[model samples]
Target: MRSFSRLNSMQTKLTLTFLLILLPLVSVSIFANYYSQSIMNEQISDRTKGALLTTLEYIDQLTQNMDQQTLLIASNPNIVDIWKGIENPLSPDHLYGIHTVQQQLTALTNVNGAVKDAFIIHGESGNGVSTLKGGIKWPDVKKDYWFQQTIKGSGGLVVYVPTRESRNPSLYMSEDMIYYMRLLDVLSSTREPNVMVLAVDKRSFQKIIQNLQTSINMNITLLYNDGFVLETNPNSENLHKEEPFSITVKKGEWSMRLEQPREEVFKLSHILQQFTYLITAISIMLAIWIAWLVYSSISKPLQQLSGAFKQFSSGNLAFEVVHQRKDEFGFVMNGFNRMAAAQRKMIEDDYEKELRLAKAEFSLLQSQINPHFLYNTLDSIYSVASSNRIPEISEMVINLARFFRVSLGKGRDSFTLAETVQHLMYYMRVQQIRKDHFTEEIELDEATKELQILKLLLQPIVENSIIHGLEQSPNEGYLCIRSRIVEDRLYVEVEDTGVGIPEDRLQEIIMEMDKITSKSYMSSPDKPTSLYYGLKNVKSRVKLYYGGDADLLIDSQEGKGTKVTLILPMGKEGHT
Candidate 1:
């Protein structure tokens, strides 16, 4: 009894399992059935259009053939013969009299074996016949509607007609579609008009429909320009005998439609609907699984990272995150630590750089004070020497006195043009006593002489020529000092016809000298540091007193000459 009970339980569980599987399978089958039906219906609709487009393309080709036929007939001289033969017909003087012409036009149509009949009709009189070898009773032009349309269709040689009665006596009892292509006889002296019609038997159009049916099991209808039904496939219930698919094809117009049974379409749709339900269920399960996986992988890391960031935000600059896994978060934590370390080092380096710059500036200012003391001591010695009355000593002492007096006039920084030139004269006299190689000329505008300038400015510039410039030159050189006031600035130019400084070195020297002594007075503090020491010292003092607007310009060339120009403010107060 216990065994029987266990077996019953197993059977019941198996039944429930099968029920679960079958329920889902049944649902999926229904959905798939409906979906497939919808898809097939849409595909069938599109295929019908594509097939119609193809049929239209072939019809267009046939129309092209008809157009060529009309043009050939119009242009051929044989057409004139056919017209002449028909005009005076004998009893047997049937269309055969024009057989040769028809044969040529048939050859011209180029429609590959599908030429059912070819004929021409006179206008509105019903007098027309086929030109085939055996004179067939040509289709009646007056009875056929295509003939009427050809007569009325807007006067172009290229026109086409639809299915109608055959003109050939061989096929007179059967129905056929034909195109009446108009022709103009060029050979006739009177310019006689002509009409040529190419007839396609109904059998040809039937075959086209049969081929389409064999390709796909669908019903189709071919529409005409006038909304007339050209052809209908079997099983096409919606396509009425007279009513077509509202779309029309003109002379060369063509269209097609497909009709599917409502019951079959609905059955297919039911199956497709079952398939959609299955896919939707699977997609929902997948979405839930993906959500769980994302939560496991991303949620924990984000929470920990948020905590670390909070700590860092509250002034914990050295905070480091502990992440064992090597991923994007790990890389981010590493970069944050490296950036913090680099930022601290940069701050420390900036402070050290500032301290060094301050010490260097302080040392430079200390060096500038010595030159002022030397100038004052020289002035005192000059006073004592002049009082002692030693003639040559007094003369030298007097030059020294004047040089120092001008040099000491300002606060070791700047002086006026008057003071600079006074210093220049004393230095020039000293140059004559020492080397005695050059004559000097001084020209100053009255207005510029009183301008404030750097003290001892021109003395060094003049001294540079006497020492390195003319002192070494074998030939005697001339020194000319000229001053003028222009544009509210004093301009003092010292030009010498001596061995000149090279162009490349001239700008370098001038730039080096322009640095304020308090700023860069170092390396060799005994004299102003640089190649052009005197010029640099004066330029430095000028900039110091005048706040950098003042400048010393040097223009020179190899072996030609040197011109030193001083541009300074016109007043003693400040830059104007």
Candidate 2:
């Protein structure tokens, strides 16, 4: 009995050790298998969904391409010329016109891949009068119930139909058949009159089949709009299953069946599961072994370092780290100590210097702008008062009020584009009032009227042109503000027909703006500040709002004129 008890004790110890070693491996393998299966299922589902949607998208794109081709052929200028020439089909010239129609259709078909062939159908309406009726057919084009239904349903409807019988034989194999068709009415340029039926080839259907096969590992079968199975890529074994998986296409007028094997998708998931199991097993074993060592090497040191960092962040940079070993943590602590010391010394040396520089720059900028605005405002008022122009004085006051109102838009960064334009107009009015030498015209597109623009953007550019370009010219100058939107961009051009910039100076200005360091001339406090302060302010603000895309494009010819353009961010009008 004692000997049996000893053997049992030995077996229990062996069992405990074995479990300790093998438990992680078994857990990892099971987890990996389950995860792999899940991944495979997800991939299968996604591929099936994407395949269905892509098939519909392919059909839609093909339909659009065909419609565009038909419209192009119908609206061809040559068609009208041919119609005139074909007054009498018996004439040689009239026969040449008939040939021209075929030539035009052929040329269009070649350029538009979706178009199979284009022909002028020689058919007449209900009227007894005979007329030229023409229609084109795509390769493997089909005649299906959809075409007949559309013909009988709508008097003059342009419809997309199944292409089962409409396949163009020239493009597809003789044995392969089409399953769908798209029919459209060829219309005159006025579009009110129908000329003929324009049918596109079933090549789009072929593309849909090919793409669906590439995207999904399934036996895909497309059904016509009238619920007829048009095309199927399948194996013989699965062709006549009594009960098949049917997937309804919610996005399009079609049906699908993914009866293909899903083993590959599941196989990928299995591979991932195996990898994850291996990682998890390794992690669990390492975690147990490292838990104890981590307390001394990583966890304790990390706790000490964290406390030191917190102290340092709270302005106690003099705090010391107590780690002794020469490892990563020791090196980090040493670096932190050095950084803290350097930061302390640098702060002392640079704090006053930075503050002084900032204050001086601020004062200089303020002094420059303060007197400039004062001069413009005072000059406008003085002129109005001197001329006894009460209405002009009132206008000047209103403009001044509006300018300040925009300058402080509740301290917000942006204002409505209309407000920007309004303020810019007031500034221009003030400049015109003060100088009375430059004539300006402002035009804005209706679409871009409500877009938001940075405040004081155009005013400075306009001011710069008026000051540097117009002021230098002896004769009257012209300034125009024109704006338009191309695609998604808003382009505002401020052009002046004054003394244009010299080539050398223009190149220098470009370099200066590019580097953002044209402050040498701006350093002088006694010189005129309009060109410097206004330009610098506008440039800085533009950079703040839109980093690099926002810019100034200057085009000029000395003695002709200078145009300062602001390219800025574009947004929809009244969009929050």
Candidate 3:
């Protein structure tokens, strides 16, 4: 009661209120000056550094552009091919090669105005082609510093200043010039070691720093590796006392900095300090009023959430969700409170079990076999066919590439029958090319082509027909694939005129296909021993997804032929 009386007393209350207002105001005055100055300095630092980085990025991009331009010319198969013709330079093919190179360089210059000229300096012969007024050949440049630097760069790029005394200096003719040099692209593991130069004006970089300095009241400087100043924009102010903030430009030996005037930097902080005094009395009155509002709006929720935060920080999931509906504070409170409420309600073991189940399901999906071996085999064939220049072989290779691209499910898991037919068409073209051992035919109704199916659905079935069936036959084989919609059901059939399965063996396939309906899942421990690697695999999946609506029918005679029929429900089309 005595403590309560003391708090209620007017003298005590006024005294407490007076200290609360005066002490903070005094501290705020000093703190505001320091804090404002710190913030100002920090903002200037970030802006200056950001501007520096932007300039550096532009320069780096320009260098990369120049490098790309050089590669385009140096790797010009025409230029490399003409090396034989270019040995004499006066030969008809050499002149043609030179003319071709000139056209390429001229096009490059027309596209990018930043580049002055693109040239290739031959390593051994020392003669080369340049874009300066068409093409010009030069004498051996074994002693040139830029050429020496190119060799030192070791196929990478090097940026250097072109001097008046440097070789072919008159070609650039300008005082402000930068030379980006690199060795030629090593073709077929053989280092040609030719020098490629891209001459650009140094002003391209200076203009960047100049553009930046217009907005900022600071002096900027770009320096080379040996402390030589490359570019600078100086602001007229006392910068002697202000140490410049420095940043290193990546990819090259370069550095840049911004020097801010001490006076301009602290200008706002001084104004904020002076205004602080005028608002002291106003702030004191505001403090008394805000104290009452804070207790109701801020204090209670903060206390509740603070405890909850402490519980969370301590790794204990024992806290109630705050349920306030007043303001943004209430939104924050509710989020925490709901989490605390959920922590108590959720079943821990069940949640972990759910996660494990999801992961196992995903792992099962990821483990499914992909036809990469076929891709590698096709890639090898494509490479050989491409080099051999065999038109039929190349066509087969390209078709096989298209087939795999569609079957691999780049991302899509389902595609229309049109795409499926296109894939099959490529597969048949490839098999027909390898050897005309089989006459392949495909028939698909225009209306039924829009129906969708799983990727690589018919590949294994068709592959088996080609390999196991026709490859064994002494006579030319015949294979037919037909797709159509009938009686509101999608029917696909593969018929082959090759050695067919016996009745006993056909029954085994039927039994294997039957087990798919009972298992529901695709993979089984019995899968290895069973002959389900291809046909049964497909049948199981179709049965699993379509249930009783899907059917796989197999019929054969030991000497005549084999026919496999696949029936899927009509509504399964365009599932994705």
Candidate 4:
């Protein structure tokens, strides 16, 4: 499974794709190398064979001319008659015949350049007449192996490589000379016939082989009757070591063999093969490089994009794919970055709007409470004064004046815990005048008193305790407002002993506040009723002003009491 997954990776896929494209080209290159080598081998063989045949033809022509010359010398009427008459070559009577035969042999040798000498031997007397050694006696001729063989054989024209002993000493004969012999029976009745022998220099044949060798760059070997004759290249031992291309041509008793080294013959093919291999290697490297480039260009960006998407889905709006390319991947990455930025901006804008709306709602609630509370307080003061000049009326008026003065706070949105607590005491004092059944207790930690808090943050909770918690109770109620610092946070609690809230009503109030916390307070078409409306307002104000770091929690029990705690983080100012 791991291997298969790796194969599916971008780098692997790119490599495989490059290989797929390269496969056919590499195959063609290899096949062409093989095919070209085969063609070169065949061409070399055919061409070399043609050259060998040409050399053979030249050699055959020389031998054929020599043979014709030998035949002509033996069949001459004078030579034939002289041979028939030459029973004793020491006699003066036949000296003329022998001399005449010598003249003919001389002419025969002179007529052909390849034939260095010619001889006519009398088979019966074992004597011969040579162009070089004229009037040879029977004993002198009989001592020659050529003469002995010619006399013993029944033959027509035959070529021989002469032994050193068989060469005529009188003539300057070379070892490279060949002899062509023809037995003549001009006297048909006599079985003892004469012979005509022509000594041919092999230099002419060597010249022909050398010319062919030079033109074709090959080694040429001439064979006469399967015997070593001459070779154009003497250092052909290396040619035999390795397989070589060879061609043989035969003409009569002579055969020509042409040899060329296989490497030399297919040199072009070998070069092509090497060139193809080099090109293949370079192409493979280039393919890998291109695959790597593609992987870098495509795969890396895709992975970035994939990761960005995951982060975005997980609510990380700041995650962005970074790329510098101007290709498609770059375009996609840029789009992704724009999308994340746009989404982040949208969320921030929505949050800002929610904050503004909540602020406006809090201000409106504060505005409504100030005027209406002043009217009620003034009326209550009127009632207290009209009924009696009570000390309570004086206290209510002073507290109401102080409450209004502190609630205004010179347009400040927040105040120190001490100032906010002092404001709360003034409001509770006014409430105490209205409802004497409740008594208030205020305890503040010095640490908390100096901490800054949102204005009107505690007032609504104390009002709720007085109006809803303490006002309904027939007996005496207690109200406690306390502030403390705990865990780097400011905690202010308002506790009351009164009728308290039923469990179901408390749950309803909490659910309503939760709804406002979860969504924008102004999202609802209708405003909250008077029931826990001040608490809802405080909840919304706290959420908007302090965000999640501040909260309002309510605890209540039937006929027991109610408590509302405001939690605010230290060292953080509430949002206006």
Candidate 5:
């Protein structure tokens, strides 16, 4: 009884090991079968459609050529003159003229291989010339169906595809001939207008379908006006079944139909499916045998690894697997141990860095208190100056306090366009008090006033413009701050008519700004200061807040002026 219980335990383990290997093999086989069939279906459908399109284009070209030929013959001066002069069909004097017209018609049929025969018929007397039967007299030609149809067409070209019984006996053309007819009214005579007809051979269209069939091994049917079957390869009526794979493409009045048997199209995929089943069966049998042989060796190590993985997933990054034998499993276990140790170290290092960053940010917040204190002191001084009735001191102190208050942003990092512009005004007012040489103008779009932007974003740019651009000029300078929104981006331009930057210095500053705003510079510990530190600081902050889409562009000319444009993206919340 104890031996039977042990045997049952062995059976359960073997079954589990076998199933673990078999399930994935079966799943892969199933996926491969489905994917291969899908690919084959798509490829076959695309190839068939492409072939049908090619055939349609060829047939359209042939029909167009036929129409052009009919137009060319109907308007021929020689044929028009001779046909009009022929008053008597059997008269000796008019026989030569009729012969000339017949010769011209014969030449047309001989030149173009697609034209089987050409004819010129008189509308009233039913007497005209034919390429096949010259100087023929058909007294009832006016009563003929094609002639009456052409006359009713009112000079427009008409095409006719004749059945077997309706083939023209006078021209001796076959049933496969299509007729293109038009009234010869190029030169108006007193008599009824003559009719010009050309019999086009359908073999040209048949040849195109045949060529396509030879390459793709499919049946093709050419239809005229989606109704009449002009030609079909293999000459079989029932070869193209509606239930099978088929495609139809129409061009103008002509269309092409392509068909292939479903079984024939998917023959290769069926073979692949069969082969896959065979492979899957053999793999399952082999997997069961392999599982039996290696179960004892792999069972314990897999359990150890699985347990270690569970612990590691449950926040135990220090978990490791121990194995003595140096096989594939041992290699995996050793890799897991090293990976765990590396992961634990990475987490520790990241935590330490985050803690340091938090402390630094706290230190920065603590440092801002002094600026607030200064702002308060300036406000108090402004009040004192107001009480003493010193307007100049009062204005200066108020502007200074407002500038520092806006710079601090009340512990917020963003403000509306109005507040931002108001902050810059405070700074500029303080500067104007010191030096009144520069004239300032601020033009902002009313629609852009509510757009939230980074605090103090424009202050440093304006400062650079006034100090470096306006101050260096000899005459009175102009400083203009304009704001507009274009294509969902806010554009702010600070234009100064002062001594501009030299080309060399501007290029140097541009290259330095590029370096400062780069990812590598942001990650580095050392960041050197530059003469254009304000501009660099603006570029860096724009890059940090708005990503790479925001831009700071400086266009300058020595002694002319400088324009610094800031393009900021208006994100979903109206701030970036």
Candidate 6:
């Protein structure tokens, strides 16, 4: 009985050891398998991708060669002169020219094996010639959809893939065919719109790529920029099942895709998984001998690390890891202590920052209250000055009071267009008291009358026009403020028929304004200022509210005039 008990103890120890070894071995095997599978998949994908790219290049080159060949037939001085010769198809000169054009078409078809057929259709003569094996298939080119679209699509190249039965015999072998049409830049005066069409059999072009894809069992499909799939080799029905990888070349408006079957792609991985089971079985036996060693190396350290994290998650940051055995877990425990301390310090620092920030916010709020007081003070001054019975002083005081009233918007970001115009009139009236030469025209659009725009957008711009442009002009100084809605945009243009800005100074002023605008700052004493400061101030405000989508354009000619146009994106109420 004693001997039997000792044997049972030995078995239990062996099982424990085996579990320790098996756990890590299985994890390592999974990682190894995943890595190996990725490498093999990449190899398969690369080989297939290379084949598709090569095939795409060949097709592109073939089409380009076909285009050049068709151009030769369409623009041949003889062909152009033929169509211009006579309306009667039986005329000897016209018949001879038709024969010459047909011979050129036949030579083009022979230029490349992929070029199944070539065609030339003329509008004036009402005839088309095709190198279809039998004869020209159809006489009236206008009835053909390809010819009509080619004329409608301007003079650039056009591509067509037919769905219905094709008239050309070369296209009957497979439905996979493409036609390239280009309008000839014919020099003849009497010749109608001339178009050249080149038919390519995709199957014939794909033969050059068959050997390239042999290394990897992947099928390729070609696509145009507009998502039109060009039927190429092995365009099997299973394409819809798998998501394909694609490649596109810069010069061509074409994209190529490669697809592989799920079973084929995972064949090697399945083999590796079978081998993994064998490795796992062998590991269990070997593990029984060194179970105690693994427990000391991995399990104990892991237990300590797990306990520390568990405590940390439970709101107990104090995790005392006493195991000093130098290993990866020991490093982890030390890192945790440092991280915990840093997090606590960061929390304390954040609390302190919030306290200081609150004080600054309070001061900012206090500063805003000052604007409200100024409005009240202006109202008080207006009453006192108007009571004195001096019209000049009372008028100036009233305008000043109105200007301040419009400037203060009770914390609203935007004001109505009418309010903006009213503010401009108040400011302008004040200026007009001194500069009598300044004449103004308000050509505000009816549509913009009720729209909401950023407050003070037009006031600064108008002020700058009057002070700088009109005041200095040798001619009769005139200022025009016009607002209109063009499509989705709201354009507010400030025009000054005064001495315009010189070309060099105009560019400098624009650059300076851009610097301020890009910084996206409101006009403040702390920011770098501009000489054309009012314009800069207005631009900065415009950008701060609208970002880069809004535009402020300045155009000026020194002797003629100056125009500053503000374009803003419109919202339901006004500029968004």
Which is the leading candidate under lDDT? 5
Selected candidate, larger lDDT, 4 vs 5:
5
Per-residue lDDT over 89-197 for candidate 1, one digit per residue giving the tens place of the 0 to 100 score: 3245554655666576566445545667667655434345463433434435445545445545433553344334324323332344544466456444454334666
TM-score per candidate: 0.34, 0.37, 0.37, 0.44, 0.42, 0.41
- Residue 211 in candidate 4, Cα distance off native in Å: 2.1
Evaluated against the true structure, the overall lDDT of model 2 is 0.58
Best by TM-score: 4
Candidate 5, residues 1-576, lDDT tens digits: the string is 474466557767877878887898899999999999889989987887887887788778877887787778777777677666456554787778778877777888888888888887776677767787776677766666677788887767787776655534433335677888888854454435588889887887677677776424467777776656564546544445546667788888888877767667788999989998998999877976776556557565666877998999898887778669688779988989998999999998986886576445434433533266687789889989999999888888899897887777667867888888888888788888888879889899998888888777787788888998898888898899899999989998999999999999999988987775524333555544757767876776677567677889999999999999998887833384
Off by over 4 Å in 3: 1-31, 83-93, 133-140, 163-175, 215-217, 223-229, 232-238, 241-255, 273-576
- Candidate 1 local Cα displacement, residue 537, angstroms: 99
Residue-wise lDDT of candidate 6 within 410-518, one digit each (tens)? 7665777777888788877877766677788888888888888977777767877887788888777778888998887899999998788999999998888777553
Candidate 2 lDDT at 335 equals 85
| Cα lDDT, all candidates | 0.61, 0.58, 0.69, 0.74, 0.76, 0.68
Report backbone clashes per prediction: 26, 33, 2, 0, 0, 0
TM-score, cand. 1 vs. native: 0.34
Regions of model 4 farther than 4 Å from truth: 1-23, 90-93, 137-155, 163-174, 186-189, 215-217, 236-241, 268-271, 284-576
Evaluated at residue 130, the lDDT of candidate 2 is 15
The lDDT ranking, best first, is: 5, 4, 3, 6, 1, 2
RMSD vs true structure, all candidates: 21.1, 23.3, 28.6, 32.0, 14.8, 20.9
Query: TM-score of the candidate numbered 5?
Result: 0.42
